[model samples]
Target: MRLRLRQFRLRTGPHEHRVVQPGQPLRHTSLRAPEPIGTLLGDHDGLNRLAGLFSFAAYSRHTIVHVPLRDSVPPDEGVGELVDLVLAHHTLGLRPSRWPALRRNLVGGTPLTVRTDEARTDRDSTSWRERHERTDGRGDLRHATHARTFFLFGNRDVFASAAMSLALAAGWGPRQKGVVKGHSAFMTALPTLVQPPGGGHPLELLVCFKPYPPYAHFRRPGRRGERRSAPS
Candidate 1:
């Protein structure tokens, strides 16, 4: 099989999330996750904007990817060149294991639906999660929404996550989570097995992400005015 590369861009900084610069996370009461403090992507126009960039949904419909889901690619090569560049040089302290991932079909951005009898017990519940899982629990709790999700990730983790997201997008389908949110540049790529014009099967690469001012800093609500971002 032969493989080619295609590219796309997902401008994520426009959404509520930003990169975690090298400093204390200026914790926000209204932010998504509370940890080293990561922001979560939510059901907003931002997600829709990001989703509009990819046509994996359309591409898959038009063409056939040569690689079989069972024949998983290696972590080093699974997501392809651009992500490999990210993991290899951009990501600090991360190893190949950090990039382990699976692929799925590219579905809608978020707010995907799932069915259940009762409700969602997960930290956060969303129709998308259920759809990704593609199942509803047999119990009473069903059709839960608003599951806590990582809409954006801390800078430390974003690089690694982006690779995983791409791998995931190729398989189960593309969704909002398939992006690595960053301050200056949000990164995402699509890994697909595509049909070349010659009629043989090959792998293809698609890349994209939101663009933002590199290191736009915001003041903490309180304290000595800690910052989630540092000037680049």
Candidate 2:
């Protein structure tokens, strides 16, 4: 069966930016500032609704690692604590140890760190792109050819247009397989066009619907619960 690979980017904020190459420096920074806490929470709620739709699908085994490319300042609780914050608030399911060496390598290094929450704020966007390329070559990321891989970026266009080009130019397509998923105000903002490497399959956009706040009104209360009197 032909695999239905999908790709896109996650837009954290108007100013949030990303680099596709993994080891290069971020050439530009997002003009938008970090999203407000309320907005983030709302987005998470939407994601949860979407997740419910795929609960029954037979998804392949996959691991999610949080790369601290940006927001590297160690919170009062440190990187591990920050990872937990992402989990509890966003339900992203990222583990703390997935990128254990992120702190020391955020700067002066390849710009890619598997560390927890070390603030990577200092480095510009190009760094993450360069680091992603390096990791794709030397790390478990190489498994993409055999297993489906997805690189979720802050902006799909930026990474796809920039990073994919670099990978192709460097002769890395045969080894890397999978797609990019872009996150925007809504998933619909992602582009419909995609030119796969070396005449590969075209990129596809997958839409997952998120439940809106009004859904709560449609839900019925449990039988065991005592009902309160309706207001006149």
Candidate 3:
């Protein structure tokens, strides 16, 4: 079935001044500075609208005009650029725990709708509502404005690893890239992407952890998500 839809991609990078890797696992530093520092990676305009993307089938359902990624994650076919952004963010040091939100923030019973009120919904959050308002909350984010919207079609782990595997396949890694391993656990735990629980299909990845603080360089990827480059 052919469906007319707008594609919106949510790809952003660490700011030039920020260090991409965390030297140590964040100690819940303070609500003001959350561990993964989601916002530190900077904002993308299409964030809100991504929640509304739909599959071709949804186009037939009148009540819903757009399909959401979590509903049915897309196959990682031609999403290399988006995947590279994921790898780079990890390479630069965003933690695995925080990566999911890079695409979706359904965590903590967060409401699906934006909080129209100006006040922060939760003091401890740089939430969807908060970010929407901070960035002027335009609900009309669409493909006309951004092209990378296609990446939002899956939950973080599967989507990220599918992309990461491509990097692994290309021989890009901490060892060859010479970049510090940001999702250190990814290197060891997932050492290589493999067929998941269902097996016999495209491989999936395991969860990655953040490095502990105090910053000791890992001798290799196996040490732990225990040491990394922290933002300066």
Badly placed stretches (over 4 Å) of model 1 are 1-188, 191-193, 199-203, 208-211, 218-225, 228-232
RMSD in Å for model 1 = 20.2
Better candidate by TM-score, 1 or 2: 2
- The TM-score values for the models, in the order shown, are 0.19, 0.20, 0.18
TM-score computed on alpha carbons, candidate 2: 0.20
The CA lDDT at 76 in model 2 is 22
* lDDT string, candidate 1, 1-232, tens digits: 0112222222223422111110111121111222222221212122221222111121122221111112222112112111111111221222223222211222122222212111221211233233433433121111101222112211212222233443333322212342223221223332221122465433222332222223134321233745557556
| Local accuracy of candidate 2 as per-residue lDDT tens digits, 18-45 | 2112232111111111111101111222
Error of 1 at 58 (Å): 9.9
What candidate 2 gets wrong by more than 4 Å, as runs, is 1-149, 152-194, 198-201, 212-232
Reference-based lDDT, each prediction: 0.23, 0.23, 0.24
lDDT of 3 at 150: 20
TM-score ranking, high to low: 2, 1, 3
Give the per-residue lDDT of model 3 (tens digit) for 86-155. 2221123334344444435212221122111112112212233234444442321111102222212222
Number of the predicted model whose TM-score against the real structure is largest: 2
